[model samples]
Target: MARSRSRSFITTEKPTTYDEDQFALPNLNSNWVYYKGAWLVHIILIICVKILLSSVPGVSSETSWTLTNLSYMLGSFVMFHWVKGVPFDFNSGAYDGLTLWEQIDNGAQFTPAKKYLTALPIGLFLLSTHYTHYDAITFLVNFTFLAVVIIAKLPQLHKVRLFGINRLEVE
Candidate 1:
């Protein structure tokens, strides 16, 4: 006895208004200037941290690990900054934005896979810092400085509008 294959299939029609709405898209004048600016800020911080690390001395192998870990943290920070810059609708600390790749169909996607690209360094640094010998204080200072610089810049870069205010005038 030969059994016949079932031919039951349901195909729901898509809403007609969907295509119309998609075609008549709203214009989004996203300001990417801030994104690039953030990138520059990260780059500068990375360099400065490296410089400060090199200048400080009397580092044990463990302290060296800490320094390396600091580097990993800094690199992750830079990547995060860059990722944040990618254009997406953001709520005022209310809702999370979509992932970079999710917005790729809209002609936007972060160039690199930031998760692993940034994570590997962090993992290696952690391993080295944990097992190897190096000065906790030296690493602390350098890492703290880097963090302070990066964090301080965020408000100035994103929130503060200084277009009309004169820098020369003392407030």
Candidate 2:
């Protein structure tokens, strides 16, 4: 007679619990460092683009410079607010897991004074750009600064440095 085999129904894997402590507050210093670095990089890019636009053979230098500065000012304003809104990956005591838009939608409020204070740097930078003469040395300095900023902000490299992870890893 042939022998019969038995089938098994139990599994070996175990479920794991989520650890709340794993989500610590992000380093505020690191956040500021990233924010400042990104801002500098953006400014350098704007300056370089302005230089290129001014150098175009057929374009009027005055008009080009004016347009570039105007655009840069507007971009600075927008970027400043946008970056301010990005949530740091680690819980930062403030708000976690909420974008700026989400905060606005949820009725998180800001005062007029607060808004003006945030925009102050942008206004100052616009004035500086308008008043400064764009020479070759100035262009070179801006480009060099921008290049340094880019290196500092490189995703892989930055993760290893003080900034720890500037962005949240979803999933």
Candidate 3:
């Protein structure tokens, strides 16, 4: 069978809308982002990346920090925005179509965790820009990455698939 492409501008995910679960067990997929020490671990990981990159002989401090920022940005964007569905089957596929960002906090908007995740990239961009000594080129590069990630996290864009980019083809 041929898979038809979704040429639509925005694909709404209403078909997979939320269903009340009687079990009420935690969703293992997204709950971890709000778990204790999650923030600390995130910061520690960034520090480790900075340290590791700095140890590279050819890598300057600015480059290392920029690379660190890029690494975190890329990873977080994919983890939060790009990738959908749960890795574990514990939730019985309730979260199978939602990205981690949408799955977090039961899809609430402007929650503390959401706010922190939003602020994190901006903080990294500011730090990278400052450390790069306000270099024009690096600033733009960092800003672009930050913008793309931030836009995808916006409440208005929830479950939105622009240009059907990530829509399930069979649907």
Candidate 4:
């Protein structure tokens, strides 16, 4: 027996509105069950490592300071990429993702005041120090800001306009 192709008497329709709850992002900050414990763990670990390195004799304090500062710089760059909601382009052979200015145009809702509050002091300190010297206070301040971005900003990226829950839902 051959099956006959048939059409339904009723017409099909696309959905007009998605359920609001369907768009809720994972509350990584408050939802501790789904995510690991407080960000203070990482902070404490980093501080412990720094203290241990400083304790070792013959390890130049300057070198230790430089390495710590370099970590902040590298982390800042990586966090900038993730915060802008850009994916890593493996084939490009370069990380030429959207810059911060481009992200703003694309509806990134970062508070300008907050960003400048954290960034300006670090920028001025770097410039004033001529980028050659590393002070513990300045390094600590920069790392603290970077830590906030790491713990908060990356998670918030999951709720942005263009790149939020839609992407997660699709995935």
Ranking by lDDT: 3, 2, 4, 1
* Candidate 1 clashes between residue pairs 3 or more apart in a chain or in different chains: 60-134, 61-133, 61-134, 62-133, 62-134, 63-134, 63-135, 64-134
- Give the alpha-carbon lDDT of every model: 0.39, 0.40, 0.80, 0.40
- Where does candidate 2 clash, by residue pair? none
- Candidate 1 lDDT over 60-127, as tens digits, reads 55555566556656555443432432344342211112122222233233333333233344445445
Residue 75 in candidate 1 has what lDDT?
A: 54
Worst 10 residues of 4 by lDDT: 162-171
Per-residue lDDT of 42 in model 1? 47
Clashing pairs in 4: none
Per residue, candidate 2 scores C-alpha lDDT tens digits across 106-157 of: 2223433234333443453445456666576654544444344334323233
Which residue ranges in model 3 land beyond 4 Å of their true spot? 1-4, 21-24
Which segments of model 2 are wrong by more than 4 Å? 1-24, 27-43, 82-84, 87-171
Q: Which model is ahead, 2 or 4, in terms of TM-score?
A: 2
RMSD per model, one decimal: 17.8, 16.6, 2.5, 15.1
lDDT score, candidate 1, position 105: 30
TM-score quality measure for candidate 3: 0.89
Which is the winner by lDDT between candidate 3 and candidate 4? 3
Clash pairs (backbone) in predicted model 3: none
Q: Write the per-residue lDDT of candidate 3 for residues 10-78, one digit (tens) a residue.
A: 776665434565136688888888789998887899999999999989988778987888899899988
Angstrom error of the Cα, residue 42, model 1: value is 14
